[model samples]
Target: DFSEGLARVKVGNKWGFIKEEGGVVIPPQFDEVYDFSEGLAVVKIGNKYRYIDKEGGFVFNIEFEWAQSFSGGQARVKFGDKYFEINKEGKIITQGREDLFPVKIGDKYGYIDISFNIRIEPQFDEACDFREDLAAVKIKDKWGYINKEGEIKIKPRFAGCLSFSEGLAAVSEFDKKWGYINKDGKYEIQPKFDMAMDFSGDRAEVKIGLTRYYINRNGEIIKEIIDIEHEEI
Candidate 1:
């Protein structure tokens, strides 16, 4: 089920879309189906995948061996042997051998292009997926941010750090307390929370003492959820 007024259902060997009342809307004709995003969903037929609108109509003629949902109007799709970004209109935004995602080599992590080209040398002990155009990477027990060009955007400093959310990321220092930092690596919210979470809709859920509360990006508590149960991740 998704916010687009449709739910996924499997009937026998195929999958399709249904309504809240279990009424078949698209029928079980697809080999597989992914959740709707924006206004389209990825459906698999035969061996190729294509994007379909709410009425189960193809949005464009473009098809791929594999495809992912659209985000920010761009979707990642795998062609014959390379990955590329396609817009809603089915125009390739970035093609060629650029992987645009991180790759693991031996025991190190680095970025690679679609053709498996080592754009960024494998050197980090640990790395995470890119968020807000920057990725959190660990080198020598310190975490920092890196740009797509493999250059250090923020020097490795924090004991631990998370991917950016709402233009800020949660970081921890030697004290093991969580705070928020901007893209420039400046502390926008000082370390205070015993536990922190990523910001969503301008608000973040945090824990202090034994209670959970929601805080704005300014680090001000907006509301508290009493008697809630949670465990540290």
Candidate 2:
């Protein structure tokens, strides 16, 4: 059992969910099952797909040929030759793959919502996928952050920037020194390293001069590496 409080287990030729105590929560009745997300999971019966609640109840009667897990309150579904986006209530929101995909218009990039409505206008020179509810976008040569609603949460200031990870993102400003910034665009670790990587397990690997080391969230050097070569930045 994981965070969803249930784990998939194989029983004979079928699959079911087991609780933390190894008790069956959902009986092995479906041909296939997917992990739960947003309190629902996708289950397959024969060649049809539908969502089921944590209690193993069907969320809606409409079944599709294929489906994807919910993300940002929407899931992609395929019926016949057309693809659609639907909400948790199984209501169709859109008719194509736009919110889950980046759209390119002319020389700019932007994104849409589950309704096929333009959430972000095509104004960025480049854009990256959303991570941790925010996406990194480039305007000319600087990078910034935007919320899912397409609002500029962080202004374009960094010469280079990466997507958010563990509440912080690595950024640089022309000097080739990298640092970590919070969601509010404030520098948690002052830009001083030659290179930096995303924070993992409360620490990040950074390079200064030719030495590499790991720094904690407080920007304290916790460990040092002496064998890593000074790679080109």
Candidate 3:
């Protein structure tokens, strides 16, 4: 797929870049390539990954075992077994910071502290990072919220859910409808929308059928769009 005015194409066993007009910009030479982002792209040569400019020139002096496209002027790279974020100049900017990160053991998921100590035992079918002091966990197929201590604050009942944002989490129940629920598992807004997103500031975007709109924390429609072709919200 095309990104930032260029698309990745494979010729023989080598990957390269082509302009929107179907002309070769960067010749097929790398073993693999990722879409352009922030004016640069990640390309793999042998087992090492490196960033390259649009003109196919190397952007950084260092190479990574694995690298991701740049976003917000930073990209994630893996060295040894640890992942770190690097700036455009290939300088490590950030390392691990979460107090507890999710880890999988066998078929169940649990939480481990930054020191690699098991804080929560593996029991839930799925687990996510803590947000606002709670994390979304799944048992079998139902989703719910749990505290840092692994206590099930909200029983697994939702068909799907997003982590808490501004004290409310978007959850779906019967009929696949989505709504906002408070930390106590009480519905702040009734389930009705076909799709829902996490709240940013005071508003969240939602979709019902072909209609899309923004709703306030009170579940009131602040803005609406009708009969628009379905695309990313």
Model 1: weakest 10-residue lDDT segment is 94-103
Most lDDT-accurate candidate: 3
- lDDT of the candidates, in the order given: 0.83, 0.82, 0.86
* TM-score ranking of the models: 3, 1, 2
| Poorest lDDT segment (10 consecutive residues) of candidate 3 | 91-100
For residues 106-165, what per-residue lDDT tens digits would candidate 2 score against the true structure? 578887554334567888888886888889899899999998887899999889888898
lDDT score of residue 96 within candidate 3: 43
lDDT of 1 by residue, 1-233 (tens): 45488988899999989877668888888999999999899999999999999888888776678899998999988764456677888766643422356656667888764443567888898887678889999999999999988899999988978889899899988777899999999989889998888988899988998888899989999999777589899
Candidate 2 residue runs with Cα over 4 Å from true position: 1-100, 113-117, 226-233
Clashing pairs in 1: 97-114, 98-114, 99-113, 99-114
Task: Give the TM-score of each candidate.
Answer: 0.56, 0.54, 0.58
Ranking of all candidate structures by their lDDT, best first = 3, 1, 2
**lDDT, candidate 3, 177-205, per-residue tens:** 89999988999998989999999999999
Query: Which runs of model 1 end up more than 4 angstroms from their true locations?
Result: 1-99, 227-233
Candidate 3 local Cα displacement, residue 196, angstroms:
0.5
